[model samples]
Target: MNDLALRGDNIVKRFGAVTALDGVSFTLGQGEILGILGDNGAGKSTLVKILTGFHQQTSGTLSVHGEETLLKSVDHARALGIECVYQDLALANSLSIYHNMFLNREIVRRGPARVFRLVDHKQMRERAAHLLEDIGVHVPSVDLPVERLSGGQRQAIAVARAVHSNAKILLLDEPLAAMGAREAALIIDLIMRLKEKGGLSIIMIMHNYAQTLDIADRIMLMQRGRVTYEQQSANTSVAELMDIVRREYRAMRATTAQ
Candidate 1:
């Protein structure tokens, strides 16, 4: 029970006449990285939303940390130690790194009255610096504007923010998207560092098969709203994954022509 962080049993989702997910099931283990691979409409985002409490599963059972329950809202998910860092990174470019780390979750002065609140910038800065350092993310200063940093740096900051919120389960959407080799390597290292730090489990919605295989302990491939294949990363190859996708495409083409 403690080994599992999350599990979904025969999950389904529908929007009007369109079914976004067709009986998908999966599991994420504690302190393990699971890479979800699929095409554009393979229900990856929908599953992510459901897991993060942005959307409810039409019919399924979801368990978080051995407790079978349905998440009510993003805050509910957060209360259960679930957090997501979307691809947009969602950082205010004009704000400093420390400010972004505490975005919408700022620390207020301890003795301030309800109506007279003031942000504790010094505390946030020191804490943000410590967190970043602990996570192996080194930057010039926590006071620098986020826009001044590189793409990978921005991504790291977003991840750090989720961690600062005390996330036990982290979901990353397209985490390595649109980055050069060096930048991608930076984030990969960060992800590994988080795993090594202990007590954090991650699910990455990814497209690059090679990268996923390299980073994930296990891999699950989705095709048109269904999980078609799943395997331990160590046992799978890029060639085998491409073969499975090709077979599915061929079968679809045959059905369409009939």
Candidate 2:
């Protein structure tokens, strides 16, 4: 079987006269993590939106497992085993952990009296507990509301929920943003564990160079709606990435001055 999980070729996106993404092309391998770094307006989010089916590209093709695909909608992306966990985490604070885990896709009892379509709360709770445990997420109780959990725990719940949903390619947008050192460490460890588990591909949008270097198998840097650098994490350094950014900034300043 081909080990390539996802590939984008010459992707372009335009909003009227504004070109948000300019011919971005990249490949994500199975069971590997690709970290994206960029300044504001670097087209990182735009590329991710297109990959996750939140937006359609004006031009370019996407391939999944070597098959060309046109991601029509977010649901269509999910149907293809693609899921995104954004910075917001998107959890219902008032709902129980299991309830939040099952969110839109709830389990229903199957029987003659199934017309009422009662949710299988028991099964959901058990499975939620199992999934959290499998992912090494610790909580006092699965029945507790998400509002009662800490930031790191809430983030873990979001990731675990995505994993439980059978996500093959996971897109995470600043998963560690606004987090303290301890909380960020928790999510970082979880991401590494997920990578070690195999069969799951991850694309992470990150701003922290140190953390990206630590977790990503490969690093991609974007500037002004285009990719400026791509390399294996093991072969690159934070200083090198900063130097690239500085050079780009200098060039932009020179052009504006002229």
Candidate 2: residue 14 lDDT (0-100): 96
lDDT of 2 at 129: 92
**TM-score on alpha carbons, each prediction:** 0.97, 0.97
The sequence of per-residue lDDT tens digits that candidate 2 reaches over residues 129-160 is: 98889988889999999999989889999999
Residue pairs that clash (backbone atoms under 3 angstroms), model 1: none
**lDDT of all the models against the reference?**
0.94, 0.93
Cα deviation at 216, candidate 1, in Å, is: 0.3
Tens-digit lDDT track of model 1 for 147-168: 9999999999999999879899
C-alpha RMSD (angstroms) for model 1: 1.2
